[model samples]
Target: MGKRHSELLILKEIAELLNTGTNMDEMLSGVLKKLLQVTELDTGWIFLMDGDGSFQLAARENLPPALCYQNLEPMCKGECWCTDRYNNGRLEKATNIIECKRIEEAIEYNWGETNGLTHHATVPLRAGEEKFGILNVGSPKKTFFHEDELALLESIAFQIGTALKRIKLIQKEKELALTAERNRLARDLHDSVNQILFSLSLTARGGREMTENEEVKETFAFLQDLAQEALNEMRALIWQLRPQGLENGVVSALCSYGQMLGLNLQTEVKGLLTLPGRVEETVWRIGQEALANCKKHSQQSDAMIQFMIESNFLNMLIKDSGCGFIYDQNQELPSLGLKSMKERTESINGDFTLISHPGLGTSIKVRIPI
Candidate 1:
């Protein structure tokens, strides 16, 4: 096939995969596999960079033994020539093949075999100044690339960058929609059910004042207390859904929430409150659930939430002195709201720990890497 026709065919083969809304990792893997297959490249990998410049080895295909040594340690971490250029704002286009640092290190250490691979072409994955990462393609004993090959790689990288931006936009829209729905529900509950409970409490109070029988007065007083408790619980639920207090900070919000739940709260924070928005949201969510669980199951009036930042991780500890129950490893027990908190922590690529035994207070620890 002519050079132009071959390039067109390669893009055509990979375009659908790029446009897929499936899991990003699955899409990246499929695209990498197709790129290597269509271009006859020996090996390839794509790095998905975060806003903070950290990256994940998103996908790879046919990696040589040397780089794959120690469970692909070389490529997974550390700085290299191509990445440095990209980070330094020099890698704006597809460029000639560069020396492979990871492979060089692997060979220098006699880590494993390189299988004749040396260098690969590098393309910056960017969407109009927002950087994603880089696309690297190489073949064994293929030390040089033609201009046409670099151009084709650049085109594919553009497609990938645009698709990434589009996916992020879709996610943001969904989040906004969810937040709006939650607020609407909170408003509905406050306007309807909350009003009813308040009126009921007032009516019970009036009945207690108007009755002469001692038993009837006591019964009306009991009803009033029940209504007041329900009202407080409803207000707490509304606050959780809308999260109005989060504007000050998650710690401030948690303190207010714990008070509303009728728990005596003591909080200790040991670091600056400089967490990413998503991380803060996760902390707030899990904090709310943990305090709620304490109020319902612990039967204890005191709860403590400790926040610390160490080694680039936000460590959270929620503990209580109330009676704790034995936990079973077999079932997640979603009813206790532990499953949702676990899922939320993992969603941010964080770690979750739960510790409890009969008569011993429970503690939940979450470590989120920022």
Candidate 2:
């Protein structure tokens, strides 16, 4: 096939591959594999960056021994020419990246063999004007990329970036739908069960006053107290389902929730509450679970929550001075809901750490890249 016709064919096939998956990692890996296969290239990888310029090694295919040394340590850390140019707004098109810095350092330091690969063609991944990351492809002993080759790489990178944008929009739509459903359920519970509890409390109070017998009067008073307690618990649960004042921000919402649980929260926040929607929601839900567990296990009315953001990451800490139970590695902490908290944190690729002792207080810490 003519070179022009072959490049067009590759683009067509890759466009189809991008649509085959909604997951960003799986989609990028598949597309990179296909790109290298069709172009007869030796190596390729993808880097995905968030708004704050922090990047992750999203996908890779056919790395040299030097680059893959020590479980991909070279690619996972430290900035190189391509990443620096992209972050500084210097890289704008498919161009030959000067000598591969990472592999060059590897060779100089004798990390491992690079298989004679010293350079790559790099292109920025963009959806419209919003640039998110870069795609890099290389071949052994091929230091120069022709105009046609660079053009093809640019075309495929556009396809991949557009696919990423589509998947993220779908995720946001799903989240908004869930929020609407939760609001509906909250409304239903308040109108039905809340009203019923209110009526029960009033009826018990009337019964207590009407009863002439002392024993019957005492029984009526006890029933009224029980009904009032149930009502309070239900209100707290409702707030959990649809947290109050979350729009004011996460820390504010947690404080309001602590009030509902009758726990005094001493919270301190550092940095602005600038967080993505999904990230903010995840943090809020985990905080809610941690606080509920604290109230149930701590037997103390005071708990502390700390929020801090640094280096494009969010760190959340919830702690309580309570009688912490013995931690057994063989089993999960069901009472404190440790498993639930851990799963939620990991779902967003965040780190979860728990520290507790019999006499010492319990602390749950979660860190997530913003």
Candidate 3:
């Protein structure tokens, strides 16, 4: 194909990828695929510079699933061919090893063994003066990428980079709102219900001691016990709300939740995972829903909820040998509580699945991207 025609085709593919509206990971994968098509490069990789300016390999094609690109961290933090070109106000291609030293190294280390990236091009990905990352493409044939090829790649990188930044910004905003809502809930419990319950406990204790008649004394004792239970509940609520211990990670959050369920649930949360705001909110709601369901139906004595984080996703499993109900027939018009939970999850674009066979049991699993 002619150089200009190849460039146009690449641009079209990039536009399609950006408009895909899939999750961030999927979008990055699509971008890499399109870039490969454009340059016919034998090996390529995309490195995303995190807030700390350290490069984490965002996407790679020919690597094993378990072989994490994480260890393949970027050598240079903020400096690369793309950044240098943008900084120097030149989008020219680094066609040779001297011009594209980093690009050559990344290829040799990341995919050079398999794909043989002897030559490559580097493009700076920028969005409104913000340096997001760099796009590097390499080929087995030496001097495969020319100056015009680099220019074309740069334009494509610009398109993808801007979209990535925009999506990232939106995700951040969603997270901030979720944090604010959590803080608000915590404050409400601490100031209102917690204080009232505390006072009630004291009054009930005093009332019990003052009672005289046997019947009255028995009644007073019951009242005091109820009051104490209420106090304990309030305390647990406070813990869940404040969540200092759970603040370390999602594992703690799930463990605390299981303990509060008052059911001996072997809960496990794993993975170096962080969730976006909306996704977290959905998870919180799902947790609340499963607990509520258990309280109402899981008379089976115990329940188990497990959390596992893998790749860019979170896997949540809530299993209870509760009295299973028929969910296939539109079941019980889910109560407002269940409806609310479903809505919250759907709002953030997540999956909510409830599996139960009449005599089998109930298992609720939710998969969301982190």
Please give the CA lDDT of all the candidate structures.
Answer: 0.87, 0.88, 0.66
Off by over 4 Å in 3: 1-125, 128-174, 177-181, 218-222, 225-241, 268-281, 308-313, 329-333, 357-360
TM-score result, candidate 3: 0.52
lDDT of 1 by residue, 1-370 (tens): 6875885776787898778755777878888887886678989999877766677898898998899988989988898888888877788899975679888999999988999888999888888878898899999889888998888788889988888888878878988898899999999999999999999999999999999999999999999999999998899889988987788999999999888788999999998878777788889999999999999999899999999988678899999988988877575754649989999999999998888877889999999988
Which whole-number lDDT from 0 to 100 does residue 32 have in model 3? 85
Q: lDDT tens digits, residues 1-370, model 2?
A: 6886886787678889787679888889889988997789999999997666678899999899999989999998888999999988998999998799999889988989898899999999998998879999999999999999899889889888888888888988998898899888889989999989999999999999998999999998999999998999888778877999899888889999888888988999899877887788889889999998888888788899999999778999999999886775456655546788888899999998888888677899999988
Q: lDDT, candidate 1, residue 56?
A: 81
lDDT of 3 by residue, 1-370 (tens): 6886986877687898786644877888877887777666655667776443446566765432122234543432336655455456574433333345554455556633433334456666777677776677765545555677767777777887788887878778887777778778978987898788778777767777887777887777787788778877776566555554445555566556666657666766676567654566467657756775776686775787788877556888888887787777356535676667666666755677777777677888777755
Residue 247, candidate 1: Cα error in Å is 1.6
Scored against the true structure, residue 253 in model 3 reaches a CA lDDT of 68
RMSD (Å) per prediction: 2.6, 2.2, 10.8
Ten residues in sequence with the least summed lDDT for candidate 2: 328-337
lDDT of 1 at 294: 95
TM-score of model 2 vs. true structure: 0.93
